[model samples]
Target: MMLELLSPLPASLNLGLVLLSALTSGLSAAAGIGGGTLLIMAMAQVMPATALIPVHGMVQLGSNGGRAAMTWRHLDRGLLAAFLPGVVLGALVAAWLLVRLPAGVLELCIAAFVLYSCWGPGWPQRLLGRGGTLLAGALTTFLSSLVGATGPLVAAFVKQHFAERLPRVATFAACMTLQHLTKAFVFGVAGFVFRDWFGLMLAMVAAGVVGTWLGLRLLHRLSDQRFDTLFKWMLTLLALRLIWLGVKRLGGA
Candidate 1:
């Protein structure tokens, strides 16, 4: 019984995933935008799609939640206050819909979202506390449930609210932590049976903790300007790759 929970994948692949989780957590912790997307993409290479989304949600909940704790003092309290209710509403909607997106459509949407995050015009940000925050929360979470990682969507909103590196990184961490938690909870209530992947998730999360710590140390040393520039370009390239993948998948289909 104890071993059955972890047998769905070979031991080596499971361990590799655990290591990748740590590395990506560190990446996101330091970079504030790429970790979840990278983590999910890597897992998709070796895991069944059915097991990937919810398990990724659980791992990210741990990773971002850890970063949030470490950066607690830098969090934007007002943003969080407004965003929470919206995510709750979004989670409820997901629970009600429970729809699975076709692979091609999902790839296209994610690619579009990533591109927008990289080069989109700035938001007023002040409006975020108004209906904007609620809408952002609802739409992003809804899309996240379908697509596995909404880091770019969340990062786009977070960027509008912050210019400094630490504050942006910190607040994004909190918002993602909340979003992933909601996603995991929705999956649980929807009968995803997390127990099957629980052991692997725990191992990944434990590794993520170490990665987060190291990432924070690196983040503190980077200049705000340099961080922002790297973030924009890296995400842009990643988005382009996603678009290419989507096009190829569509062509093949």
Candidate 2:
């Protein structure tokens, strides 16, 4: 019974999930973005719809939680303090309201956000003071519930606020950790059975830690300009794919 509860997943798929977790964490660690989205997309290719969202949320919580611990010394406490209250409010609304956006609408919004992050005129740093921070938090967390992977959305905000690589990466991880934690709470309240996937989730998290360590080491060697270029290109391609997905969803409907 305990074994069954730990993981109903087949041995092969469990191995794949662990590997995917590590690779995606490595992506986040090196790029300071996109890993969570990639992980969810990769897993979505194989996971059942009923189990996918909660299970993906659990893995990301672990992945970002590990990164947050790794970079705690550099975390922006003021930013977090400003941002977190909105997260709480956002999560509460998601739990109570159950905002089920139309699939086409969500896909379009995500694509638009991704494009804006890459090419649009960004909001000024001065304008997004404490209030801006709170609104950013509220919107990102709210969208996270609907969109599956919002790392890039929050990353765009963090990048706008922090120009340096280390501080930017640290804060990004911390915010995502908080976001994933809140998501986990919403899932629990909604009665998703987390216990069933504990074994696989734990394995994936452990793998993520190793990947994060490797990626961080690589990050130090890469140039800031190079990383930024890579980040934008990757985001653009992902956004295009999202737009395509949205079109497909709209067509299907």
Best by lDDT: 1
For residues 133-229, what per-residue lDDT tens digits would candidate 2 score against the true structure? 9988887887776656778778878898787889999999999888888978877776778887878888888899999998888877755577667
| Candidate 1 backbone clash number | 0
How far off is model 1, as Cα RMSD? 3.5
Q: Give the TM-score of candidate 1.
A: 0.82
Clashes of each: 0, 0
Question: Could you tell me every candidate's TM-score relative to the true structure?
Answer: 0.82, 0.81
* Model 1 global lDDT (CA atoms, 0 to 1): 0.80
- Can you write out model 1's per-residue Cα lDDT over 22-96, one digit (the tens) per residue? 999998887777888878766755776567778999999999999999999999988988888888888888877
Residue 158 displacement in candidate 1 (angstroms): 1.4
